[model samples]
Target: MMKVEPASPQYFRSSSYSSCHDLFYEPDCPKKAKGPMLCVKQPSCSESNFDCSSIFHLQEAQDPSPSMSFKQAVVLVVAVEKLKKQVQTPIHFISDEDLYDLFLNIFEPEPIECETVELLDQPEKRYIYRNQTIEYSIRDIDKKCFLLQKPLGSPRLTAVHLQGPDAKKEVKINMAFYMCPGNPTQEAVVLGIAGENLYLCCTGESPPVLTLETVDKNVLGSMSSSELQPFIFFKSNSGSTCRFESATFPSWYISTSLAENERVKVSQLGQTAFTEFNTSRS
Candidate 1:
């Protein structure tokens, strides 16, 4: 027969304890501690009398484990989910409208993946609401993300222009200006392209800067359908994102007016291919 441990206070006794056998022979009792007088059977979960399993006391676990002071599982779950999101390759949208349309076509949730990007603002249908009359305000969250008034809107692309003496200069100009004020004016670089835009990233920067300014509307609106991969893709290499934006763009350059004593010879300024206006800034 099993009785209360000699180590336990003599006055201690639970009303639930029926007999010495009930204490030593209970299911889930530690088998390693067994002696000639003790026997442990599998927990009788199948029994109609069983209330719940008690192999592990969760309340006791909290006291010894990394006891959460916040006491909120939801917060932990949300934090873990956010970390998962940050670690994964970030998903970006070109415009609020296109993203809304993209979201609409998607049915399933959890690490959403879709091959084709759809234009959200459908001009054809007229039903409960019409965008024709609705003028919604929009804001760009740097170049990393865009915040739109509604989930739906027309597809618009972020743009970039690189004009300089050397091919490297073009990239250098793109790197310097595509971030916030505190960051240096140079050294930042573009890592990847998103939608119809370029994503400028740097190892030292907080987030990649997004290029804004559209080269062509049709190109961006139906951009996902493009089958051709051009060798020279400025926007594809440089623009696309709300999660990122430049602190300032490369300053426009002016034509040189060297003094008579100056040795520098005459040379053409930067071409207008980068933007509508010509640039002379190096």
Candidate 2:
């Protein structure tokens, strides 16, 4: 058995309880709220396996302090202890709200902002590569060339001067129109190449329950996109991060699993865990 340490003098204070050393409360408690009165500290296991019986002395506070009555204090202590036990219980399945709450409590999260990049010239036909670049040309399709569109949706409209063979073709693309907020400009609609809709699907199964896939447009028009299941992209503050909060299931985010396939799914917002890469053109 491990040895238990004695209670420190600083942890104890005078009270109307049986003994002055027996009376104690949470340190640094606010003056407005009555501090949770507890008995002298007792040693037990580590914090990971807190021995509440040894730590909490749920005895009445003899002095009738208006801040918290003895009855209220006991109820609070009981509630806290009950919650602690519930947390320790093994969880075979987790609800979206529960998972989100767990993550929110463990890792406080920040709101995501939008990042839109616009192109200077429009191409007759545009192909968005996963590598964060675009291939377009006004001339023959055989002469298609590449242009780096990293940090997609750049606010500035830069001018590109091409000569000789390069000048033979014109590239037209409006990335800003697709990513920009609100209604798209006439130029954007005419020149923009629509991107595939992304989804973080979950079936509550063993593997690959949470996976990333694009919406299949081949389906019959009679069947709505929702019927086929499509997860829409929600913007955030960071440009590189693909932060996905489900509109159907609020607070839940798209997370990647460490499995061999690197499967994806909806989970609580873990600053690091739930963050996935942007599969779409940046």
Candidate 3:
């Protein structure tokens, strides 16, 4: 003895209801408005003719006193018909590769330098790619691995030293740098890490400021290519950690600060903190 109420035109258009079948059931349509209670005979219900308007007609023939007006019934019928059309529409399915490509298109990252590397020791294959300031080491572990370390210094000028347990063994591997095709800018270089792109932009304003910002490709390309310098990392005076200094901006060095929303900045040679970064490996 459950009573089902017909939904309005607005309800039919809403995304709240996914299919027309959900409208006829009292349990699914819990929020009922005050109106002629459309009683649906549960015993006579069948899958073939389960529409709300049809059920209302069957119930109306049985109980004539409490009934909807001709105009109200027409609206309900039209709404039900629209819902039926939406439900019957063919759904186009896409492959997993296609879906992935679609997502990549929507969230394409700004172009940055990338390189691929293969590890020789382990049974599982490893791939190394440079993204911004750090290099990522991806393995067959079903997850992403990050590997960061100081670049090896020149053997001729400075003797290369190793301290860890593996230092005793000489491990040699082939490496290649895949330079992204772009007119290099002297003012700034794009830094990418963890899929985020940042530009080391220099503004020739008062104080000769440098800022890291997320800028568009064209804006980054417009900056002075001649002034841009490769990021150089060197061991600190303590011999324990390293710091980054810009090649072009001789006296300016990259440092991290505690200011809100301003974590990275370029400070004058003698004024910045002992900014240290980890060389992570997967």
Candidate 4:
């Protein structure tokens, strides 16, 4: 049975409030030795059916013995219900897109595997040696072009006779060769303007005219499809000279014109075709 002990001079100064310091027992009470207990209460329900559970109390625990009072049972029940509600609360999860974004923020994307090489553009300096016994030293010669621009500031690859002082200046005449990695034959490669993202491509037209396309060299290794074939060339070398044939059009090869200062174009490989170029790496 629980009884309300009126506030006394020992527990509290006022008689209106009741205290559980002398009424209740708590083994882990922090303020047991203190002057007065912090847990004070006002009479709410009748003494016959007291509802002390409605009011907040500190260190209000049952006795160490097996026996429990009505007040102690009510306090334990309320604490258990509050804990259950907290555990039963619904949890929210992130969407697929949001999860992917979070993953990207945490980890960096892997870089594409590709290679870059230099192609010296001196068409007249080419020497065709068809000797079979002299194994070809020029390998993986992807028919790449340098930063060749017209006077009008348009990006175009033109095979012109540049030598001596003009050829020495790398900025004026050069080609970037991109060889496909892991290929046993080393036939696959890309042609681009030296030191630029611009690549030379052909769309397999009746008379294929070279088109300039912008492609990030960093992503070149990941390209594998019909769309990428236009930019890919099959490299074949003889002595110091090499020829780049279009992967899209088997018969077509990248060729220069007989006349000087002519735009680079693709032509069907023939006896008279100017397809072979002298390759040298700087």
Question: Looking at model 1, how many pairs of residues clash?
Answer: 23
Q: What 10-residue stretch in candidate 4 is worst by lDDT?
A: 125-134
Q: Estimate every model's Cα lDDT from 0 to 1.
A: 0.27, 0.36, 0.37, 0.54
lDDT of 3 by residue, 1-282 (tens): 112333321111221222243344333343432333333324444535434333221122243454445655554565445445534648788999998999898997687988998886643211122323334221111111122222363111111233477343322211112232332222222333333344444454434444444545445344343423332222232253334445445556555443222334566656634244333232
- Clash count, candidate 4: 3
- Candidate 1 lands at a TM-score of 0.12
Superpose all Cα atoms of candidate 4 onto the true structure and report the RMSD in Å to 1 decimal: 19.8
What is the TM-score of each predicted model, taking all chains together? 0.12, 0.24, 0.26, 0.42
Best by TM-score: 4
Question: How displaced is residue 43 in candidate 2, in Å?
Answer: 95
Backbone clashes in each candidate structure, one number apiece?
A: 23, 18, 12, 3
Residue lDDT tens for model 4, 1-282: 122233332232222223453333343333233334333334553444322334332233344554655665565455445334433647788899999999999999998998897777523211111221111112123332333665675677666544567654333212334434434464566666555677778884687767778787656545554457677677787887878888767878888766666667788767444787765554
Quick one: ranking by TM-score, best first?
Answer: 4, 3, 2, 1
Task: Give the winner by lDDT: 1 or 2.
Answer: 2
Whole-model lDDT for model 3 versus the true structure? Answer: 0.37
Tell me model 1's lDDT, rounded to 2 decimals: 0.27
With a 3 Å backbone cut-off (N, CA, C), the pairs that clash in candidate 4 are 145-175, 146-174, 146-175
lDDT of 1 by residue, 1-282 (tens): 112222222222232322342333344432243223322122443433323222211111223344343423443344334334433666685998988888879855668677997898743311111111111111122111121111254322222222354222122122111221233332222222223333222111222222233334234223221111110111111243212212122222111122211111112235331222221222
lDDT per residue for candidate 2 within 1-282, as digits (tens), equals: 111223332244434433221122223222232233332334443434323443222333444446555655564565455434534656578789998999988997889999998987633222112223242232111222222222464321112334688553332432221221232221111122234332234434322234434444333123333342223333242564345454334566555443322323456665444344332332
